[model samples]
Target: MPKAQETILEIDRSALTHNYNYLKSKLQSKTKFLAVVKAFAYGNDAEKIAKHLQWLNVDYFAVAYTSEGVALREAGITKPILVLHPQIVNFKTIIKHCLEPSLYNTNVLNAFITVANEEAQTNYPVHIKFNTGLNRLGFWESDVDYIINKLKATSSIVITSIFSHLAASEDANEADFTVNQIKSFKVIATEFLSKLDYKPLLHLCNTSGVINYPEAHLDMVRCGIGLYGFGNSANEDKYLKPIASLKSIISQIHKIEPNETVGYNRAYVAKTYEKTATIPIGHADGIGRHLGNEKGYVIINGQKASIIGNVCMDMIMVNITTINCKEGDEVIIFDGNNKATDLATSLNTISYEIITSISQRVKRSFIE
Candidate 1:
C-alpha cells in the first residue's frame, strides 16, 4: 500500500482466486476449467499465475503459440496446454514439450500428423477446432468427414477435444448469432463424435460464454480475461475483482506560465498557468500514443490528472495544476477502482487490449 518508488504492476492472487471461483460457479459441477495463460498471462507474469492456477486444480491451460506452451513447460507448468495457433515448424517442439496443438485446418492438421508420426507418438492428445462462425482459424463444417478420414489414417495422434470459438457471446444484441454458432458446433460435434469410438471433450465457451450461455458449457470452459477480473461487461464486472494494478511515482513537478508547451511537437500549450508532473511510463511501456492529449488521465492522490501532450516512449507529462500533490507522489495508471476497462473505453478499445498492452519491462509484484 506504500507509495510506488518506481513504476510497478501489482498482481493480486486473492482476486484471481475470486474470479476463478465466480466463473466456476456458473458452470455445471462436472464441467472442466481451462485457464488461458498466453501473452504472459495477459501480460501479468505467466509463470506465477499459471503456478497459482495449477495449485487451484484447473483442468487445462491454453496459449496462443507453441513457444508460449514451451515457456510454460520450462516454467514447470505440468497442466495440459492447448496451443490455440500452432505453426507447422513448431510441431516437433510441441511434441517435445508435451503440449497439445489445436489442429484447425488441413495444412496444420496434416503437418502435425506427420510430425507426430516422425516422433513415434501414439495416442498423443490434440484438439480439433471447427469454424462455428469465427471465420478466423478453424475447419469448416463440411470438413468433418475429411478430418475423420485424416485421423483414421494416423495412429500417432488422437483427438482429445473438439472445440470452437464464440464470436459474439459477450454482446446481448448478438444473442441469436451466438446461439446459432452453438447450434452449429453441436451439429458438427454430433457428426464428428458419431464417427469415433470414443468421446473427446466438447467445449466452446470462453469467459463471457461461460456467463451468458450456460447451455453451451459443454464439457469444459476456457477463461482468460474473466480470470483476470474482467467479465467483458459492466454487470458482470462487479462480480469479479481485477488482479493487476499499474502504479508509478511522480518524477518531477513543473510550474508553467501561459503558452508554455509540454512534451514533443508542442501538442499541449498551456492556455493558463498550469502545473504538470512527468511520469516514467509511456508508449514503449504499452501506454500507447493514443492516450495522450487529455485522452488519458492518471489518478494522483485520489484526483484525476489529465495527460498534457504527446505520450513519449519513456515518459508522459500530466496536468496536475488542480491536484495538491508534490514530486515523488504516487500516480495510478489503472487500479482496482480505476478499472482498465474504463481507460480502454475512453479510447474505443476493450479491457483485454488495455491490460495485456502493459509492457514486460515494468516491475511486477505479486500478492501471494
Candidate 2:
C-alpha cells in the first residue's frame, strides 16, 4: 500500500478478529461480549471498528459519552450502545438516540428516570455501575437500599446490567484488591437481584480482567484495549497481534555541523557532525513534547533512528547518520516491530494514551 502524504494510522481488521477470538476463548460459552468503542475505538475509527465487531456478532457495544453513542446510532448501528458515563443534561438526547446509560449515582439515576418518564419509556434498558473499589464512578455498597428504592418506584427504566470496574486487574500485586472488588460486586448484585423480580446481566471484567480473572467473567465482559489487540501483559500480549500501525514518511534529510543545534529551544546540539531526517509528525500527531531529544526513536527502513531534538508541533528530527535512507523512505513510528507499549513506557504512560492521543488530523487507513 502507498503511504499517505502525512502520518497515517493503519488498522488491520484481521488482527482485531484475532484479539476478539483470543479473548472469547477465555470466556464461558454463554458469556456475552461488550466491545468498548469509546475514544473513537481507542483512536482507531469507531464506526469502522464497530461495524466489523457488529458483523462478528458482538453482543453489545459501549462508549464513554452520549455523543459517541449517538454517532453510532447515526451510523445505523442497531446494536445496543451503552453510554458508560451519561450526563443529566443529555438525558433527553440519550433517550432520543435509544442509548443505554450507566446510571452510577443518585442524581444521574433520578434524572434519567425523569427523562424516561417524560418520554413515556417503559422498561428502558439501563446499566448500573457500582463503585466496588475503583471509586471513579458507580453506586456504593452502602447505597444499595437507596438504589433498590429508586428502582422499585420507577418502571420507566430497567436495569439491563449491574457492573463495576477493576482498578488494578493487570497488576499481580493488586490481585487481592481485585478479588475484593469482585466479591463486593457479587454481594451488591445479589442484593439487587433479591429485591428485583428480574435478573439483569452482571459484568465486571475489562480486557485485563478477562485475561487475568476468568472466574469473574460473570454474564457479560467488556473488552476495550484487548479488542484493539493488547493483552496488557507480556505473556498474553504474545498471543495478540497489535492492530494499529502508525506510519510516516521522511520529508527531508539535513547534515548538521558540529555545535549546530536542532529543533525549538536548541534542544539538541550536535557534539559532532550528524545527519538528521525530518519526519512529518510530532506533538500534534500525539508524539508528546517530552518524547523528543533522545527520549523516543522511530524505525526507518528497519534501522533504529534516535529522535535528535525537541518534537515540533508537526515535525520531528531523527538522528539518521548511520542509516542508509532518504526522503520519502517509509518509517514506522510505532507498529508491531516497535510496539506502542514500549513507546508508552518510554513516555511513562500506557498504550491507551499513546494510541488514543493520535489526532484526528492523521489519516486512518483500514486493511482487511
Could you tell me the lDDT of residue 93 within candidate 1? 94
- Provide the TM-score for each candidate, comma-separated: 0.99, 0.98
Q: Give lDDT tens digits, candidate 1, residues 1-368.
A: 66789999999999999999999999889999999999999989998999999999999999999888998899999999999999998999999999999999999999999888889999999999999898999999899999999889989889999999999999999999999999999999999999999999999999999999999999999999999999999999999999999999999999999998999999999999989999999998999999999999999999999997999999999999899998999999998999999999999999899989999999999985
Cα lDDT, model 1, residue 61 = 98
Alpha carbon deviation, residue 23, candidate 1 (Å):
0.6
lDDT score of residue 88 within candidate 1: 92
The best candidate by TM-score is 1
Alpha-carbon lDDT of model 2 = 0.91
User: Which stretch of 10 consecutive residues in model 1 shows the poorest summed lDDT?
Assistant: 1-10
lDDT for each residue of candidate 2 in 1-368, tens digit (9 for 90 to 100)? 56545689999999999999999999999999999999999989999999999999999999999999999999889999999988899999998999999999888888888889999999999999999888899888888889889878988988899999999999999999999999999999998889888999999999999999998999999999998878898898899988999999999999989999998989899989889999999898888888888989999888889997889999999999999987889889888668999888887888999999999999999997
Stretches off by above 4 angstroms in model 1 are none
The runs of at least 3 residues in candidate 2 whose Cα sits more than 4 Å from the true structure, single-residue gaps closed, are: 1-5
